[model samples]
Target: MTMTFIIVYVVIALILVGLVNLFMSKRKRKMKTQRTEQTLSENDTSHQSYQSKFNIRDTDETSEANDANAISEENGKLNISNNSDETEALTSDQNAVTQHEESHTQEEEINEKLKQKHSAFMFGKGTSQGKVLIAMIFGMFIAILNQTLLNVALPKINTDFNISANTGQWLMTGFMLVNGILIPISAFLFNKYSYRKLFLVAMTLFTLGSLVCGISGSFTIMMVGRVLQAIGAGILMPLGTNVFMTIFPPEKRGAAMGTLGIAMILAPAIGPTLSGYIVENYHWNIMFYGMFIIGLISLAIAYIWFRVYQVTTNPKADIPGIIFSTIGFGSLLYGFSEAGNNSWTAPSVVITLLLGVVFIVAFVIRELTMRVPMLNLEVLKYSGFTLTTIINMIVTMSLFGGMILLPLYLQNLRGFTPLQSGLLLLPGALIMGFMGPIAGRLLDTIGIKPLALIGTGIMTYATWELTKLNMNTTYSHLMVIYIIRSFGMSFIMMPIMTAGMNSLPQRLISHGNALSNTLRQLAGSIGTALLVTVMSTQTTQYVSTYSQDLDKTNPFIKDRLQEMAQAMGGEQMATQKILEFVQKLASINGVNSAFLVATALSALAFILSLFLRGKEHYISKE
Candidate 1:
């Protein structure tokens, strides 16, 4: 009965969000259209006057050329009479020629004007571009929210399906792998199809995938649903970014991208907590039902209001480039994800990593030589873009490290329930969401460098504080630190990304957005794997050392063991209780060691932030 109530509550919440989003979108569109029409009406007289003047100048030039030709034909014989047959014939010929030229020129002008109008309509120059952007944000919000929503439910899924941890992990690994494969191709899709068409297809896939997952009766069916959902998610992120970049100019992009960050960052931030609550109270499949309903609403909204904001072009796909990228990025993501579960030295891990590197190198070479590359490598020529991408990757690595490690520390060692751990992190996510737009506005007005320095400094300090956490650390204390870290992250993420993309040319914006999204995904996987491996290795060593000390027969160790036994109510339970306590201590020690590594990563990002140039540098270059 409780589970039914929770499901109904979640469904109601999704319906409310969807209805509110749709109403706001329609209202904004109406206002924008009215404003654009008024502005165009106000400029109508001046626009006509300018065109008339241009037409007069063209006519004068044409007349002068006709007169010169007449003089040449007469050849010094001045025919001044008005009624002569030859003069009449010459006048008639000139009139006919002038009429033909004027007709052709007028037709050309009309065609040019029509083309401009079409472009304006497609790009939302004076219409409801904001509405389109909002709709896209809403659609992307649903897609990204789905990415991490199932994470907390994975354990429940495993128990229900009776699968091993390794097998269950494919739910995440498969999603990411499909995402990696599809993101690179989005640039081509953006060029090849209208925005409305692409958006509809993406949302349709997402809605269908969610429905499949919600009703699935087998693990195989569930995996299929996840893959379908990944295909949609992979496109939605880059698609929304490309649209955002298309509508906003570079100077204003910081704030615009910041608004986009609300969906990008907040969705993932809230996912775990939201998922935990639902999974703890209800069945795992209920989460999918909620997603399916939300996705259906998002798709309907998109179909109704999403305008084509960019013109489509005819660009053929580079088959070779696609193959290399699939092998390269796909292998790398898989290898890192595996490293968290399998030893780094395992044959599968080593072979996949080596193959990934080799293919990536080959892909780079092929892109450089291709006339039309799948992923634009030429964007790397801009030093600002290059630097910003590197910094973004490093920061993403550090962020993912904390996200994965904190849960382990809280749940495994501290014995917190999944819902409790999720709730602990919820406040930080809320803070980050609130700060996103504010940071973006600051980025546009104040600049990225100062914000980045201040943000990274706070983040580094917060990460360092986390390293001091032990078994006795208070929950409130951890929450405070996480909140500070989230605040810092809000300033650094979107602003830095906006600054990098600002350095690129208009023609390369799609490619630039695609590349940034792809690499950030890779960095998250790699960072999580690297930190998890470090923690595992360190925990093993710590446990071995503690076990050896316990065997020494020292008085302190013996007394402590006996005390734990007594607490468990008998000497018979002493060995088991003592070993469990020691193992918990070792886990805490290992997590601390891993956080130290995270602190180092945060410090590195801070140092790199110092090198980041201001927005003025990019503006001046432009």
Candidate 2:
């Protein structure tokens, strides 16, 4: 037992060490990527600035060319260069020059107007690529930390609350359900409020929620706190992506958004192990307490470094649109969240699902018809954007959906501690964490398709390996599987983001990004719900089948039962103990089979990834 404990400790430590290394490496990579992107943006700016001054010269050139053309038309009769001001201004002479120059000057003026509009849209006075990247990356960390920290703390919450296995899921499920509803509303808020203000508000809500959750005396209070965190998290998720597009140049947005994938992997990697330590040695509330402090620090940093005074605003609060988006997304997620606990055939489940569908459909019709739409549907006209968004949803479902199963299987079935289970996730989490940014950087050089293929291929293998896990599987075997899956996730995530953003106009970047992030969150929620439902249903079947051989009439079983009862203090107590033990054993096996179901979902994700198109690295046409 000591040896096993030591091994577990070592595994946990290694995973943390690996994650720290990966984090450090990504920071370094980010700096390097930032420098390169900055240099390119600077060069573009310099070229555009130079071209602006150069245009003054062109206006004069056009005037001179028109004068020459007039002179030729008159057989050198105009001689405007030598003429007196009064002579040159004569009606007959001026009219001749005006006739030749009229259409040409009008064309030049139109061209200049178009150029100014393009410049205003792409490089607004206050917006800078560097500033946007910084803000978005920070948002990424906040969003990720919010979700991942809770994952580690859930088990301790279950023990403390004395909740059922299914009830325990609400801690996670509720967060996602609330978060999903918040995402669509967030897009409108981003337009309505300053990004800096919205971000600070969200962080504040999250911090406050953490405090509430940490100090709560009852499950009800804890649930409310979780809801607070969800609200903040929902806003930040899409906002993070929006910031990237708004701030970064069209060409460099891929590398900027890639940082988010790194955050996604890193948050989960650190959250579980760190929270595990907190729960084991201290109180489970320590997770939220820690989150509160982190949130405060992030909030301060964001406010100080990222200014709100300069935030662009042309917001008209679309009350109708906001209502539709919230109700639509909220109902849909609620249905998924409730599905794991309630009978699928129950009226509540059916009614909630139907309501979800109705709201979503209404949201679509309303957004399309609105004169000033909150979500610009025009961006979806791009095939690359549409396809990548689908890919994002599928991958998110696979990754987040499968994540719900593995930890549960390790802890409930294999009897591993939270720390040990989290340690197991570390390898994959770290690898994938690094994979996303690296793939993002690679998007700078090669292309997205090959990287995506590589990612999907690894995921396929990892999913296949997952299908093979059983009750007696060793730690080493699981580690290998996680590593492959993490690497695949890293490869696939960035490419999908880059591909989608690459196809959009700079002005629509924020709206497009918001859509992508929203889908990713929805995918996670749906995936988690789907997997939980599968596991619960499948486990019931497995338990019934496994219990079949314990017939009461068998002579050997009957003799063994009598002997067991004799060994115990009394027959009555012995029978009770035997039944409890049997139920526990069945529960463990049931969880193991649930993981097998998760493996199948991942396999499905791999198949979907195959259909997605490759990288769309930006090359300026002009």
Candidate 3:
């Protein structure tokens, strides 16, 4: 059909535009690098530049006696007694210049020492933040990987458990439900306990969960394991972020978040591919076994590394806030997760969704009225946090849309093996891992607006290209587009999130992190439901149109039927084949439609990102 050609033309149209946008992003990074060099050069030539980075104040009492010669030169040119001491004055000026250079060198040395001392790795080489960050990244990577690894193994799990798809899905839904409940509660936990204690609890729970899942024989037992994993994982992510915010200065947080983003990007990227291999060859339970062992290692490292950087305050527990948060977020996420399998209008779906909204409203009111809120609703008052949150939610939905659709297109319609399908995403994932830290540094140097703008711009163009998917679309084409999409995403998620956190005062970072993660979690589920709904809705229309054309009245159908009939040996076989082809085409059309919706969302995110204030908007760190 002529519709198949639409995909080709769309790809062609987008390639040049995508290239142009990517080139502009590259140019911006270069420009930012050059500015950094120029600033360094200026700092070397002038003492005034030291005021900002090194805090060189003019207060005489605070001045270093070792550097007094440099200051004396500036105090009316050393007050030389006419021509009698002209030679002496010249010598004094030379001495003053040397002292200035030495003072600058000393400042640089102190900065370098601080940088090394705070580094994130430890073989006894770094301090609390760096060691803890490394351990958290390791633990978080495995936790995220465990989720994706389970996705690839779910079908196998269903067969083994002799359960229906709906029953099997409980494994994932349960994990998410626990995560949602725990995430909001994390802010309260952070307020009440030291991070060292939280890290121990989180890692212990996760490692234990992995062991339970690996060894459990019954479905009920496995569900228990999943809940444990969720409890551990839910706390780990937000707690890791909160610790980073506490330990690192505001100016450096972009890079720190970016460093954390490496695990975030790589785990999901590598998981499916790795899981596909393991699932294809080995028993499914082996994954949990591996996760269990790795979890123990992570647990041990995190325990040794995480430190209590600050004392915890005991905020009075908001028991009512706790109930509302759990009920509201849990019900809402559950409803969204179910909507794709059972239509949105299903009675159960509608009831839960309505309940979720009502409870969420009640929860918000309770938080607002409370003296010390459980989740800190007041963080939304900052315009920067609010704007980025909306944009983050939108982009997250679009991201989940792409992530879901591409694999379905690859393995279902295209009939690629799971390994092949996952490997296609690996390149993009690896690239994103590489770019994560770079994007963060750029965010620090150039700010969030540029990174967000360029990221969303590329995402918009790339997703727009995916809307052209058809039965005839090539595997390579899908992979290329997906890679471009991943590249754009690396620049967006962590940087935008860090920008939102930076908007809040120091005390509220944990709450902001909690809210951001919780909503994004909700957004991911809602996006999955909505995009899948769009696909199925479009599939129905296309199927109807296609079914109508399958009648003998259509000449194109006549020719196709005749060709298939001669090749396959019977009219019945030919008709059946055509019907199969029609269904496949209709499904492919649905995927394209989903991507189109994603493209529009990306465009809207780009527009909203344009309004996100840069690093200049950040509250100064305490």
Candidate 4:
């Protein structure tokens, strides 16, 4: 039934495209004919005027020659007419015609300018570039949203599948690992294939993945679906970004990318909140089913809307590069991911991390030497792209890594409902969504440094505020800070990314996009791991310290315990309650410690912002 529906949908889509294309062709032909006729009429008038002037001159010369011939015949004397005035008039006529043509050309140039302005006003109406982005953003939105949605649904999924926490986490970890692996490969895919084919293939995989997940009865099948979704999503983002860079010029790129940033930030921000509501009321599969339906819609829109921006070309594959990238990024991401659950120093984590570093080094060396690299390292030679990429990684870590801390504090420590926890983030997400375009405009006007500094400053302040969170911290307080933080974020991400990408030459855009994404992915994973490690390690220390400090023999603790025991059923129950309280205190302390680290990261980004500028001009690509 699904296959049949898809086939029918495609048939309908093709018919619709045929009609639209027909209309577009007719409109274009009519416009072309009008321009041609107008040009011909102008040319004919100019030609006739020139011909008439020459004819007048010729007639005078002819009459004069006839008279001269008669004189010569009658008296054997020769005569000639100078006719300088006629010659001057003919020269003047030629100048007038040239000026008329120049003026007409100017008018046409002005008309073209007007058309461009009108197109800009319409936000790329009657343009395939706009339609492509519009369609792709939907897929990007759902794919990124899928990343966070499962975070909220994991508890329910765990119960349904009868899995352990570590086991359930693989659903998230596996998705990240797969996504990280595919991102590097996507740049190669982009260079070798047209945008249309890649978009259709990516959306198909994503939509199919959603279907698999929606119907999965076990964890193994669910993992398969998640991996499929990851592969599709991983390609969609960099591809969309590269297409944007290809179509929009530098001046317009900031605003255009900023527009895309809405989907980039908003989708993940609202995912958990939306997922929370669904998980609270519906079955876990509903989330996947919802994705499946939306994915189909997005796929259809993409099919109808996308244009072929780049034609397929053969690029020599680097097998060594591929192997190194897969092992390096995959192992590194897995290491960071597991570092959160297991300690950083665990044998497996240590081994994988070391292996990742070694392979990544080899990969970099391979790319640097290769004539046709799998992932180009030449983009890094531009100081502007290099700097922005570093700052981007830092900002991503501080921004996304810090995001997880709130949910942990709200839901686990404070016992807030998942919906309530998600709602806490809703206001912030909405703020970023609203401000993305505004910041884009700001980026174009004020420049990259100003926005970067201002954003970092606000983010630093907001993250500093999070360190003050405690058992009694008000929910409103958290929401307010997150909103402010979101505002700061709106200015930081897109502008910085655009500046970096814009710094690269046209040929290197794909490489720059891929490398930037690869690093950002690593940073997010590492940041999350680092922050979680700090929390876990600190919590354990705090628990031990609290236990040691609250000695049973101490008069102070003894008095408190007696009063609690007298009020409660027994001393043992009071002791248990005290232990639980101590554990909560330790956990909050650990959370605060994590926030402090995040604050420092944000501050470091702020300091780095001082050095940030707009895209640098390329001396040469080689």
lDDT of each: 0.80, 0.68, 0.80, 0.80
Structure candidate 1, residue pairs in collision? none
**What TM-score does model 1 achieve against the real structure?**
0.83
Give the worst 10-residue stretch by lDDT in candidate 3: 1-10
Write model 4 residue lDDT over 510-618, tens digit each, in one string: 8999999999999998899999999999999999999999999999999999999999979999999999999999999999999999999999999998887543331
Sorted on TM-score, best first, the list reads: 1, 4, 3, 2
Of candidate 1, the 10-residue stretch with the lowest lDDT total is 1-10
TM-score of 4: 0.80
Please report the candidate that would top TM-score against the real structure.
1
**TM-score on alpha carbons, each prediction:** 0.83, 0.75, 0.79, 0.80
Worst 10 residues of 2 by lDDT: 1-10
Query: Model 4: runs farther than 4 Å from truth?
Result: 1-127, 614-622
User: Candidate 3 has what TM-score?
Assistant: 0.79
Off by over 4 Å in 2: 1-136, 152-174, 212-227, 307-313, 552-604, 608-610, 614-622
Each candidate's clash count: 0, 3, 1, 0
